[model samples]
Target: MNILFLTLAKISTLKERGIYHDLMREFSSHNHNVYIVSPIERREGQKTTEKKEGNATFLNVKTLNIQKTNFIEKGISTLTIEKLFLNAIKKYFSKVKFDLVIYSTPPITFTGVIKYIKQRDNAKSYLLLKDIFPQNAVDMQMLSKKGVLYKYFRNKEKELYNISDKIGCMSEANVKFVLNHNSYISKDKVEINPNSIDLQLVTDVSEENKKKIREKYQIPYNRKVFIYGGNLGRPQGIDFLIETLQAKSGDKDVFFVIVGSGTEYDKLKNWFDSFKPENALLFPAIPKSDYDLLVQSCDIGLIFLHKDFLIPNYPSRLLSYLEFKMPVLAATDSNTDIGTDIVKNNCGMAVHSDDIKSMINAIDTLKKMDGAKFEVLRQNSLNFLKKEFQVEQSYFKIIEA
Candidate 1:
């Protein structure tokens, strides 16, 4: 089968495999033809507009240059690219028969193109959702519930939901949330298809490399290192992370290293500067090989989510931690569903999001865990992942569905 997948992400080379790219590669390796239409925020003056990687092809759209002045301007620019890119793809591929069209939503507005694909090729459509929109925005107070923008985005979200032949939610709570909100969507249509890492690559980092990484990052070989890497933004509730840093200011040996960029980077940096918890280190994003090496060097991983975001987002970063045989210290609430998984698998401790005392307690307990017990916990997580989160299982299930 030939599938057309749509996402608003920049792709230069295929080596930096994330969720969408991993899934597409899975399908392609199984002798399926997969093409992607990825929109970007900038070009960086690249010479090539499109490229191919093995069985998969990438379509890079040239979009308008616009500086966002406000929320309205940002929304308009996002939708404009969606309209132009989707239309341009349809026009270019008029003669090609696409068996299925899979579109993931964050912008929810792009489902308009899914409707068009279904009509044009009679293709089955899948909504692989990572985040549920306007509601998440509203929960974050990023937009007012009564605003015209809220209603517009909400209506678009519903339209997107209604268009999918199958809906792949990132977590069980998100699946349940969809079923409760839409009478048209059956429980069977909404199912768990959580984010995953390329297990092969994730498992390939060597112990020797890990030691080298530890030395490179200036992480003391004798101390416990807790690492968090990914987008640091609103949903992460980084202010509370600063609270964790402040609470741990006197601790001597434990190291907390944060690596990534987002809107909250400056805020987190400012707080880090003021506290300078002798142990905490801050750095921007590093190369994948270097990042993987650091993950292996760490003793524990950190996962954070806003307490109010009842919407479930199983961070893809968790799988990488599990792959490295490092236990997670998930700082989130009960509503996150992540805590449920951690407890079920005996992988790590889950602390209440707003409770600084609880977080400190978790940190202390994690610090004191016996080395052999830590290995046991890490093994349990690896077994769980191999049994369920492997990319091969995802390939079979998605294809069969």
Candidate 2:
């Protein structure tokens, strides 16, 4: 089978360890030829190019920066990407007859591309519904539902859904939301296909190595380290995270290690500069290998989402925490089931993002757990990862479509 994947994520090679890369590798390993159409943002100073790694071929389409840019620039980029991707597919993969067209969302402007493929090659289309678009923008008050821009994107969103033969949502909440909101979409077409990755055994970092990492980062060895390693953007509810740090400033036993960059990075950095919180340390995004080591060294994993969001967000970062056997602490909106799932599985605790007192209390709960109890939670995290987030599960789900 020849699979063509359309995505906004930049994938230079299939060797990289990411949700998409792992799933693509799974398809490739099964003797399928996977073709990817991903962006090469203008900031990368690269032209449209095609390359192959293993059984996958990546057609890197050149486009304006759609992420971490000003609203106007980001909007322009998002509006233009679909056309750019369609042109690239025609130029580079004109002869290839795709058996399946799998794509993810952020910009739901890929209806044209998908329609073309379905008509040209009679391909089966699957949507990896990662974001609930214009609605999410409206939830954050970034766009007005009454505005033209909202109408434009909303129409595109409908078109994209209509074109897809199947829609793979991240959670049950997402599937429900899609069905309720889009009455045109049949229930049989939607199912839970979460953010999954290739499972790797958790290896314990030696105490000496852990000590070296702590020393290198100036983290206290005796303190319980809670690490948040991902985009520090508006969707993450950065303001609440800042308030949490301020509230925990007096705690001497807990340390916060934040590592990520985004539009909200400066806001968080400014707060760190003003408060100089003794219990917290902030760093820009680090290399993946270094970040993996940091996750292993940390005592707790943290995830945050804006309380305003009505969309059910399931961040892939949870998988990282689980794969490393670290218990999680998710401060999220009520709509998302991520926090609830973690607690139900006995992997960790979840608190409402708007409730600072609840978050603080949850941290204290973690702090109070004895080594024996904490070890059980860590094992639960690993167990949840293996059961729910394996790349093979995602591969089978898409193929079954």
- Each candidate: how many clashes? 0, 0
Candidate 2, which segments miss by more than 4 Å at Cα? none
TM-score of 1: 0.94
In model 1, residue pairs whose N, Cα or C atoms come closer than 3 Å (at least 3 residues apart or on different chains), thus clashing, are none
Q: The CA-based lDDT of model 1 is what?
A: 0.78
Best by lDDT: 2
Output the number of the TM-score-best candidate.
2
Error in Å for residue 275 of model 2: 0.9
At residue 49, candidate 1 shows an lDDT of 63
The residue ranges of model 1 lying beyond 4 angstroms of the native Cα positions read 43-48, 64-73, 201-209
**For candidate 2, lDDT tens digit of each residue in 1-401?**
99999888889887779999999999999999999999999999989999988779999999999888888898999899989999999999999999999999988999989999999999999999999989999998989999999999999999989989999999999999999999999999999999999997668889999999999899999988999999989999999999999999999999999999999999999999998999999999998889999888889999999999998999999999999999999999999999999999999999999999999999999988899999999999999999999999999999988
Error of 2 at 211 (Å): 0.9
As a whole number from 0 to 100, the lDDT of residue 40 in candidate 2 is 90
